[model samples]
Target: MTGAPPDVSIHHLRAITNESTVELPDRVVEILAAVGPDTDVLVSDVSARSFAAATRRSYSKQEPNLVPFINSLQALGDELVLICQVEHGDELVTAVVRATDRSLVAATAIDRSVGIVHITVQELCARLRASNAPGVELALEVASQCLADDRVRIFEQGALSTARTVLTKYTMAAEKGFDVRGLDGFAGALVPLGDEQPGFCIVQADTSVGITAFTPGNADVVAAMGIGGLSLHSETTEETG
Candidate 1:
């Protein structure tokens, strides 16, 4: 799929939940009615027990901005579901994201639902770091495959958080054609060189794992930073004596 454009615009719709039953709000129903037959939409419930559904059209080889949709829904309540669809590259892509204890659960444009797919931060990072594929494409693949299989588990609480830091650094480095401070907060800050070429440098790849911080600017950067991988703290941290 082609990358997202700079200055991307996203359409948002929200529905309120009823206290008696789990029915959608009028606004949500209205938005769904407005969606065209050709357009796909994503529906998600981000309550404590999160759930999500994506329309079939979302799988097409195009990009859609669902960040606003997710963030808006997140603000409304700890528990709510919203559906949204956007057109990019003339193709319809529907998606949903749910916040869970360890990480945010999201849906893919493909038939696979993002909520059901279980990809940990470590596996995603290792795979992206190893592959030559664009960040977005690879993220879809990794998330999809993980969902299809039951035996694989690579993430913990800190994975996605860590991935974001790496992604920010990678994008900043590429954006300036040089390093940026705080990009690698965990690692010591790389010395910032304004004009002169530094002798030592951290390697920056052309593509990045797709994640929110790197989005909204350009599809290339989105593709480059597709869903940045997670950084998982060891499962077995010791308690202080």
Candidate 2:
């Protein structure tokens, strides 16, 4: 006989700012808890598990019923907050919102296994940050500029070795680099160590390799290699420049 389905669980909860990662704050927790046990929370179907699937399943027009809920989360502050809830053998719900004028960037539910919820959320966060976060925009801009310059080719002697040197130069120039843990295509934050700025590089791995850098107020020279698809080997931090 088949075993009973797994119970609902919160797979991930964290707020990301330009500076650091913040655990679910007390106020935000209270708002979510207030939805009450009896509320019929809308969750996505199991078939839409990956990012593409979730996007396909997303509502073309925001549901009026969800507006208040989204607003409540956005009211918290400007920090980008992500919440992921999973019910094994059933549905998964994820919400991402922030207070840059307070809007919901993403709210989706998909069929997902409990084992992979963390990975799913990590990817979701990375994509959202890359496309939306101002800090990430600045970092990518720096990277793109480096790619346009021929001078960046000086470090292409070895793929992996060049990647390390590139990252090292970036870390040194930025003053620090915060390890981004599980996300591919993301190396780390290349902002000043103590400054409250948000800047990060996206490294895509391929035959060649290089690095890039960014500063909050002024631009600085970094590194660059090649470009195509995005992939980052966690251990080596190797990716396309």
Candidate 3:
């Protein structure tokens, strides 16, 4: 199917509920009747329950730079796919995120139309340190896949907090090479390198999974210091965090 969205029938649109109604843009709501009653659909934003208030500032909306998602319950048709799986245009669009308490909780995305799907800090960090757990490897694999698409964009989140990103150059081409399949986009490779102890490192390989050492403006140091990798392309360079 070329990974692009396909034409969905009218019999598949899911309605939005109070729980996951945040991402539903006004435009998406306007198109609901267009999909017909039976159209298939999916939703990838917001949850019946709130995400854990784990950010540096839980008042994310107050700080424009800290927000993760922007919309809720708004899709054009019945068969809307936010991340090729997260359904949109449906009332049951709330996504379940693994909470810190070991129970599944609902978390919403600002915009589920594209980019990487968040697996949650608890799940991601644990998996990244699991010795040989497939979760860490899978995250790397998705990041590797993203660099291939010319339209993709990779942005790293501070492994710990909402700090600005360090590396600006991210070249995953054959010269340096990567080994992953079904990459979501360039955004995947932008690993979150936190400055906390046990910094991130980078290991080269046909399919080797390693850490990425990163410090703001020290992209060059990652080489000698055995740290995380950085993004490439001068044009992509911005003071973006």
Candidate 4:
């Protein structure tokens, strides 16, 4: 039993120019600003149970169809889908687009290549604001079925699964430090807090010690640990901030 399926809501959003004749909603503008450009974006609302199950499966060798699961949200309510490629690092921010009160939603980056993301929402808006292009009014049922079929080809290939696994490890490393490293199915590096940071010590996979992040100019912090120490942060928030 992986877990329960998450209750998902699907929203369809399209890019509209700032100078477009149509009036845009504040929610749409804010999301566009946070996400920026480049990379495709998929919006969905899923039950915490389903999301947890998917997250568990993500750690497994088998791959799960994320977009298909997202598409399934269409039938629950109005379907609003925005397809944009979010850049690997910077443009990968996620948010929740509601019917009228759109707000930021915490998202865990799954497969960045295809922009597969997870969000929990109870319902979605009936329509989007300030759209001058076609494809914004996709039928809920049609989009769901089409996405289900398309996800099959990708799942069979297994690339998405592999990517998700590596990315998940990377996220864990950055957040929880290298202590989470060396666990089964985890493969990644200990990145320093900054380009020229000195407090962080990079350790190799074969070594027993784990790598971690830290603020620059904190050699004393590293010295106190005596070589195998993995410092995730320093006393000051200067670099961490």
**Best model number under TM-score:** 3
The per-residue C-alpha lDDT of model 2 at residue 217 equals 19
Q: Candidates 3 and 4: which is better by TM-score?
A: 3
Badly placed stretches (over 4 Å) of model 1 are 1-115, 134-223, 226-241
**Model 2 per-residue lDDT tens digits across residues 1-241:** 1111122223222232112333333434443444445332221211112222223223213333344444444444334332333222223344453323223344434332222211122332234344532334333433433333222111111122223334444445334433222112223332112111112233322421223333321133222222322234433232222
Prediction 4 global C-alpha lDDT: 0.27
Identify the superior model by lDDT, candidate 1 or candidate 4: 1
TM-score of each: 0.21, 0.21, 0.23, 0.20
Q: What's the lDDT of the predicted structure labeled candidate 3?
A: 0.28
- For candidate 3, write residues 1-241 as lDDT tens digits: 1222233233333322223433444433444444346533321221212222222222243335323332221221222222211223222122332212212222332332233222323333334444342224544443343332223222232232212122221224223543332222222323233212112333322333333323332222121111123333212111222
Q: Scored by Cα lDDT, where does model 2 land?
A: 0.30
Regions more than 4 Å wrong, model 3: 1-25, 31-48, 51-132, 135-241
Least well predicted 10-residue stretch by lDDT in candidate 3: 218-227
148-193 per-residue lDDT for model 1 (tens digits): 3333321111122223335444566447553222233321111111
Candidate 1's clash total is 21
Best by lDDT: 2
lDDT of each: 0.28, 0.30, 0.28, 0.27
- In candidate 4, position 160 carries an lDDT of 23
